[model samples]
Target: MSVLRIDTSIQGPRSASSALADVAEAEWSAVRPTTTFVRRHLGAEPLPADAWAAAITGGPLPEEQRTPAQRDAIALARTLADEMRHADAAILALPLYNWGVSQHAKTWIDLTIAGAEKGERLLEGKPAIVLTTRGGGYGPGTPREGWDHNTAFLRRIVADVWGAELTLIERELTLARVNPAMEALLETAELMRKAAHEAASHAGRAAASSAR
Candidate 1:
């Protein structure tokens, strides 16, 4: 079985979202020892910022008439879309940045859409595990209630657009231990962390079974 894993965390080794993905991938590999993993680390090797626009504008033009940049963008976009289309399962670690999707993740999403056939479900019938982390709490009654703009969009794209069987794992207050202002919430953050990890394990095993 093939699994596609995309990690979009600039925090590297300290990334909370990637940590969750590690748990999920571990469980998946444990269950499916022969699973092939395709990895894309957007933080380390980001897609070209202008690729999406280039692809969209160049798509209608004849190949011979397209500029080099446009051709390359179109090719890269198709590759991104192909990864999802070919994968049996996917694990996406996309953390909240500035209360919304990070630029890297958005670029990837746009390029994939630009490359796909109109209305194509790239991950149709596949199992997708989305691991997202937030530095602050945005739950009900919290100071930043309703401030989360990331999770909903992820759901729409992964589940609705891609037509995947989605499993979402989220961790909030990830910065409680690092941010002095959030010190009091450290206990709650730990609890959320533990829960998210447990959820990741469950999602991973479930995905492995579904893929098989």
Candidate 2:
């Protein structure tokens, strides 16, 4: 089986989202030792800024009539889509940026969608897990309830647009230990982080089982 893992944390090894993703991937590897793994580190290699616009406007045009930029854009989109199409499962690690979606993640989604034909959902029914880390709490009843602007947008693209069977693993209060302003919540944050890792492990095993 093949699994595609996409990491969008600019923090690299220090990112909570990526740490959880590592747990998930490790669990999957333990269960399926021979599974093919594909990794895309968007933070380290972001998509070209103009690629999305070019792909959206040029994809429907005949190849012969496409401009060079359009050609390259469409080609890139196709490459990303092909990875998803071939994967038996996927893990996306995304850290909330300023309470919103990461620009790199958004670009990836837009480009992937642009590559698909009309009415096509290339990743339909594919098992996909999303690991998200937020600096603060935003659950209901919290002071910042409804403040999270990323999750809904991600769900729309991952589930509604691509038709992936989605599972979300969220770790909030991620800045508690690092940011002095959140020092009081350090204990809680540690607990949440632990829970998130445990959840990721379970999700990974489930993904492997489903793929098998």
Tell me the lDDT of candidate 1. Answer: 0.95
Residue 137's C-alpha lDDT in candidate 2?
Answer: 92
- Predicted candidate 1 versus true structure: per-residue lDDT over 1-212, tens digit per residue: 89999999999999999999999999999999999999999988999999999999999999999999999999999999999899999999999999999999999999999889999999999999999999998999988999899999999999999999999999999999989999899999999999999999999998998884
Write one digit per residue (lDDT tens) for candidate 2, span 99-207. Answer: 8999999899888877776657766898899999999999889999988999998888888888888989999999897789899899999999889999999999888
In each prediction, how many residue pairs overlap at the backbone (N, C-alpha, C within less than 3 A)? 0, 0
TM-score of each: 0.99, 0.96
Model 1: colliding residue pairs: none
Runs with alpha carbons beyond 4 Å of true place in candidate 1 = none
